[model samples]
Target: MTTALLLAVVVLGAALQRVSGMGFALVVGPLLVLLVGPVDGVLLVNLCGLLFSLLMLATTRGAVDWRRLALLAPSALVGIVPGALLLAAVSAPVLEIVVGVLVMAGMSAALLARHAPALDGRFAPVVAGAVSGAMSVTAGTSGPALAVYAVASRWDPRSFAATAQPYFVMVAAGSVTVKLLLTDARLPALGAWGYGGIAAGCVVGLFVGRALAGRLSPGRTRAVLVVVAFAGGLATAVRGVASL
Candidate 1:
């Protein structure tokens, strides 16, 4: 029953991510933590999120801005080392709460802010990459930081989604690698069924999201998705607080 529920959650979350390029963790990360315990949940979210990005990138390769990749990917990789070390020191519950709060706060701000500052300066991408990298490693979700930068840059939906695919894939890879190398931390032994479920959920969700994405208005859909993500983040934070 638990596994089935988790699969359902992943399907929904990954579907949102498919359309938005940023909602997978905000939608599913917190609940996964509650369902499987914090460490395993974060590991699961990162891996599954990575898988989703790979699948999305497969079809959207042409749309990605190659120039941005140069600035964003390396900084994110550099950020992972410190984030993993921080994860080692922090308690699971505290991390969960922090992830939840950050998700909600960032999404809310993105929605409420009518003015998006232009990313014209040379240093803008660098700062965005660093913050995104830290967030990705520590919280298993880098979308908010990327979202903020994407908004500021006035990127269209297609450009944002395509550009984000590589960013997310790299950050997740670096984060997992750091966690494995620098400390005793490891992905919980979820066995074959767990891995299978994650793969299946992401594949189905991605295809579905692709099919539906063309039908929605990007601006409106983005706002709606943020609202949903906010709700999911709230739930995760509440669970974390309740557990404490």
Candidate 2:
């Protein structure tokens, strides 16, 4: 039952990511933390997120904004180190609560401020990248920060979506490295079949998302993603409090 649930989560996350270009972690991270412990589940997310981004980049490579990505990557590292330390310092229940709250706050912030002032300044990417990195490490969600940034900067949707893949790759890699160095967090102990299921899920999700690309409305997809993420985050927080 657990394995089936995990696979379902992975598949849904990947499909959303394909449709929205940045929802894999937001949709899946909190739920994974609920199913598994915070450490292992988040670690699994980083690992899988890394691969998911790589797979996405294969098709979206043409639209990447290299200069924006260059600015984002360095600051992301700045945030990652501290985020790793914080993750290492917290207890599992505390981490779960933190992840849940972050998810909720991030989503709320992204959803609420639809018309934020334009942020076309030179330093915007740096700030966005740093926040995204911290969020990625602590909660495995980078989309909300980038989403806000995209809106503020009036980034082109195609470029933003394409650029997000590589950015996610960098964030996931840095997050995993720092966690390994600064904490005892290790990859989840999901066995061979489990790993295989994850791979299959990713593939299936990408395919489904691709098929639905023209048929599914982006606004509708985003609405469903937001609802699921919010509910999952609340449940995770409740579970954390109960455990404590």
- Locate the minimum summed-lDDT window of 10 residues in model 2: 216-225
lDDT, each prediction:
0.75, 0.75
lDDT of 1: 0.75
Q: Return the TM-score for candidate 2, rounded to 2 decimals.
A: 0.82
Residues 16-61, candidate 2: write the lDDT tens digits.
7776677787566766666567777788888888888888888779
- lDDT of the structure predicted as candidate 2: 0.75
True-structure Cα RMSD, model 2: 3.1
User: Pick by TM-score: which candidate is best?
Assistant: 1
Cα RMSD, each candidate: 2.6, 3.1
lDDT of 1 by residue, 138-177 (tens): 6677777677666656667677778889889999888777
Model 2 residue runs over 4 Å out of place are 90-116, 216-244
TM-scores, in order shown? 0.86, 0.82
